[model samples]
Target: MTSSLSWRLAFCFTLWLSQPLSLQAQETLADWRDVPVAQLEQGAQNGVADAQYALGLRLEKGRGLLQNFALAATWFTRAADQGHAAAQHRLGQYYFDGIGVETNAQAALNWLRKAAQAGDATYLYDLARVLETQPEGKPLAADLYQQAADLGHQEAAVSLAVLYQNGTGVAQDFARALQLYEGPAAAGQARAQNNLGLLYVRGNGVQQDYVRAAALFQAAADQGLALAMGNLATMYENGFGVPLDEALAVELHQLAARKNSAKTGNLHPGWVFDTRLAPPDSSAEALERLRQGVTRGDPLAGFLLGWHHLQKTETSQEEFRQAARLLRSSAEAGYPPAMANLGLMYFEGRALPQDYVLGYMWLVLAASAGQPEAPELAVVLSARMTQSQLVEAQELAVIKGGDQLANR
Candidate 1:
C-alpha cells in the first residue's frame, strides 16, 4: 500500500508497541486505550523502547490521546536511544520539517545518518535532499546523492543521473547518467526510462539506438508519462525508432496533444513538419481535418483551426471568433500552446477587447507547463502593455474556468 505521512507514523507506532517483551502478545487498539496513560508511562520507564516510541506518536498526533509535543519528543528520544531506525528517521524528519520540533539541520542529519546506516532507503533519499540544498561544496552533495542512489532510491537515481548529465554536482558524464538511468528504468522507473530513451534518441553516451529509445519511451508512455508520449509521437512521425507510419504517427501525436491539453488545460499547437512533409493541398486538407476533429470533441483540432485563422492575411471577424472559441476551449483543457495562443489574442485585442490580465495569466500557465517559447512570447506581449495591465492579466489568468468557457 502507498504510505502517506500519517500511515507511516502509525506504522512506526505499531512497531514500537510490539517491541516490549512484557507486553501482552494480543494487544489491540482497545487494549491500548484501556491501558492507563500512567501504565504506558511505566512501560517506557521499564526501558521498553517500542512502548516509548508508540507513546510518543500518540502524544504527537493526539491519536486517542492528548497532543503533547514535549512528551512526544521525549518518547522519540527514548526510542532513538534504543537504535530504532524508524524512530530515528521520524525524528530526523520532525527536525528537518520543524514539525513538533525546532528546525535543526545538524540534528536532522544526525538522525538521518543513523537511519541510513540501518539501510533505510527513504531516509537516505531524504538525507540526500537535505545535503543537496546546503550551501556547502557540490562534492559532498553528490556523494550523498550517490549513496542514496546506490540503495535503489529511484528519485535519487534520477537526480544523480541529471547532476552527472549536467555536471551540477559532479563532472559532466553523459555515459554515467545513461548507465544510472538504465538500471532504474529497467525496473520501471518512468523518469529514468524517459531519460534513457532521450539519451538513445540523441545518440548521447551510447551508440545511436532508436529502437531502444522507442522501446524505453513506450514503457514510460504506458505509465502515462506525458513527455515520453510526446517524444514517442515525434519518433513515430519521423520514423526514427520504427518504420515511418503516418497513421501511427498521427494517432500518437493526437494522444500526446490530448494529454498535453488535459494536463495544462490548453491545446498544444499541432506539429508543423517541414515543407517536405506538407500535403499537396495542405491548406484545404488541414482546415477540413481541423473541422472534423473539432466535431469529434478534439480540442487540438479546434486550436489548429484557430491558428489557421490567425495566420490568414485576409482574416475575418468570424474566423477570429471561431479561433478564439477553439483556443479558449483548448486552453481551458490545460493545453499550454492554446493558453499561449489565447493570451496572444487577448494581448493584441485580435478578436475581443484587449484584456492584459487574462493574457498574462494564460502566458504564465503556459510557461509553468514547460513551454520553451512562453517566456519569449510573454516578454513581447508585456512590451506592448503597461505594468498594471500585465499585473491584471496575471491575476485574471489564475481564475480557473477556461474549461466551462471553452465548452460553451
Candidate 2:
C-alpha cells in the first residue's frame, strides 16, 4: 500500500465500486424484483443464477430485507461460481474492499478479470481501476482504460489521459492527453478542468497561458473542487495571471484545507502513495517577494498588500486610504475580487466616501468577471437605490465593459 502512484486512483477505485450494477442483468432482475423472499431463497437454493444474484442484491442493499453482507457474499459467490457476470463483479468488489470477506487482492483480481471478460465497458473500467493500483499492472491497465474509453466510458477516458499525461503506462503524449481531457472539461467535469488547467500551466500540449490556466482553475474552484481552489490560491499568491491578493489567497487556502479535512477518510487500501497536491507557500520569503513586487509597481503586489491592510482590525485612517487607493488601482485594471472588495468599501463608506452608484457599478463589473458573490450584493444594493441611481449605475457598469444588471 506504499507504492508510488497518484492518490487520485483511490477516488477512481471508490467511484467504480459504488456504481450501480450494469443493466446487463436488468431483465432478469426485473423478473425477480417482486418475488417473495422465501421463494427467492428457494430458487437460489435450487441453483437459479438470477435468483441467487437478485437475493444477494436484496440482502446487500437491505431492500425489504434486513441487511446482511455475509449472506449477500455467500449468495453472490454462488451466482458468480455459475458464471454470472454481475455477481462476479460484486463478489470481486467485496474481496477487494473487504466488504464482507477478508481482503484478498489475488482473488479480487481473478473474479474481476472474469467479469471483465464478459465485455461490459463498466466491468472493464472497474478492472482497469483496480489494476492501476498495482505496480506491474499499469500497461494492462492502460490497455483496459483504452478499451473502456473506446466503449464510451468518460471516467476511463480521464484515467487514460492521466496515464498519457504522466507517461506511466504509455508513451508520453500531451496531445492525446489534451484530446481526452477536452470533451470532459468542456462538459464541466471538475477533475478534467483541474487537470487541463495544469496542462495549460505547464504548456504541455498548447502554448503556455497563465491567464487561461487561472480561468480554468477558477471554473473548477467555483464547482467546489478543493484541489482547484488550492491551485487558484497559489496563482493568486504568486500573481501568476490574476492580481496577487494575499488575504484572499489565505482565505482560499483555509477554505480548501477545511474541505480536504472533511472529505478525507482513512486511506483506501488501493491508495498506495501520498501524492496529494501540495498546499501553497505563504511564508516569510513569500512576504518579501510581495514587497519586492510592490516596489516594481506590480498591480498584483498592490492588491495583495492592500487587501491585507484592509482586513486588519485596527488599521489607521492612513492605512485605510492606502488600501482603498491600491484596491481602486487593481480594480481599474480588471481584477474581479479587487473590484468586489472596493465596491463594498465604497458602499459601506469605510475607506472612501459613500457612493452608491459607483459601488453598484463596481459590483456589476465584478459579477460580469465571474466573481460569485458580486451579483447578489449588486441586487441587494439596487433594491435600496432610486430608479435614477440604478440607471446611472448600469450606465457606469457598461462603460467599464460590464453587462447591465438591469435585466438580472
Candidate 3:
C-alpha cells in the first residue's frame, strides 16, 4: 500500500481503538484481532520486513497503541535490516530529527544514502539537504547533491544550482547553475521556474531573454508564487515579454499585490511594481482595494494608497492621516519602505510634528533593510539634527527584533 493509504488505515485503527472494548472488538478489532499483537511481534522477531515496518509506525505514532519510541526504533532497525526503502527513509528522518532517539547526523546520512541508492527521489532530496549545510571542508557534500540532482530530484537540482551560483561547496559556475535549473523548470518546478526567470532577467547565465523570462515567470505565477507574479507583472508593464498592455499589467500587479498582502499581512515591504502599465481606470477602485488591504493589515497597500494621493493635483488631509497611520503600522512591523516613508513625513513636517531624531532613526532602519537611498537620506536629515539625536537614531537602528522583511 502507498504510505498515504497506510497512514489512513493507521488513523482508522486509532479511531476504532478509542471505543468501548465491546465496540472495539465488534467494529474494529474483529478484522485485525486474528493478526494479534503477539503475531506481529513474532513476525517482526522472525525478520518479516512488512510487519516490522507496520509495527514501527504503530509504535512511533501510538496509533491504536501506546507510544514507544524505543520499540519504534527496534522495529525500524529490523525493517531497515531487511532493506525496506520506506523503512530506511523513516529511520533516517527519526535519526535526523532526534524523534525517539538522540540526534545522529551521520546515521541519518547513512540511512538516507541507502534509500537514495535505491532510487527514492524524496530520500535523495533529503540527503542533499543534509549535505548542503555540512561544515566546510566536507568535500563529498556537493558531489552527493549533484548525484541527487542527476537522479532527477528537482529540489536537489535547485540546491545544487544555488551552490554553484554562490560558490558554496563548489566553484562558481553561473552557466552550470542555469543549465541545471532549466530541466526542472521546464518540468514545472515553481522554484526552478522562478530562479530561471530571475537569471534570464539578469542575464547571469544566458543571454537576456525577456520573452522567455516572462514565460517562465508566468508558469510559476500561475501556481501562486508571488515573486513570479510580481516579476511577470513587471514584464507586462514594461513590454518585455509581451506587448506593453497597461490595463493587463495593472491587473497582474493588483493580483500580485493582493496575494502579497494576504500572505504577509502587516509585514509587507515595498517591492518594485511596474506601474508603466495603464493607469488605473478608476481611482475609486484602487482606493477601495487599498482600503481593504489596509484593513487586512497590509502595509504595502497603505503606502501605495498614500503615494496615489500624493501624485494627485489635490491632496487631502484625510489621505495624509491614513497614510501616516498605515506607514507607522508598517514601520513598527519592520517594513523598511514604510519606515522610510515615515521618515520623509517627519522630515517635511507634513503629517506630524518635526522630529528629526525619529526621522533619522526610521531612515537608518530602512537603510539596514537594504534600501540603497535610505542611508543618503538619513545623512542629509542628520545634517540638520543634533549629534546626540543622530547617535540615538543609530542605536535604535541596530535593535534587531522580529522579521523585518517577508522571506523571498
Give the number of the best model, judged by lDDT: 2
| C-alpha lDDT score of every prediction, in listed order | 0.66, 0.75, 0.65
Summing lDDT over every window of 10 consecutive residues in candidate 2, give the lowest-scoring window. Answer: 266-275
User: Of models 1 and 3, which has the larger lDDT?
Assistant: 1
Candidate 1, residues 1-408, lDDT tens digits: the string is: 112111000000112111232122123123444566688778878987767776776665434443344457777888887986666766876676554567788898899788767655556666666676667645676777788777667767887887787787788999999988888898998878888887887777999898998999899989987667767777776777677676776777688677755443243233221232233234677678878888897877766677777767788999889888988887777776787788777766778787767776677677655555665565445545544464455445435534334655
Clashes of 1: 16
Between candidates 1 and 2, which one is better according to lDDT?
2
Q: Which residue runs of candidate 2 sit more than 4 Å off their true CA positions?
A: 1-12, 15-17, 25-28, 34-36, 265-408
- The positional error of residue 342 in candidate 1, measured at the CA in angstroms, is 37
Ranking under lDDT, best-scoring first?
2, 1, 3
Model 3 whole-model lDDT (C-alpha atoms): 0.65
Give one digit per residue, the lDDT tens place, for model 3 in 1-408. 111100000000111112122221133223333476778778778887777876776554334443345568778888888787766767877777565557798998888788667665556666666665567622466677677677666777877787787787788898998998889998999878888887888788799888888899899999987667777777776777688776876788788777755442222233222243343334678779978987898866766665665555666877777667877887777666677888877776767887877776677667656555665465444446654565555555445322343322
| lDDT for 376 (candidate 2) | 53
Q: Which candidate leads the pack in TM-score? A: 2
TM-score of 3: 0.46
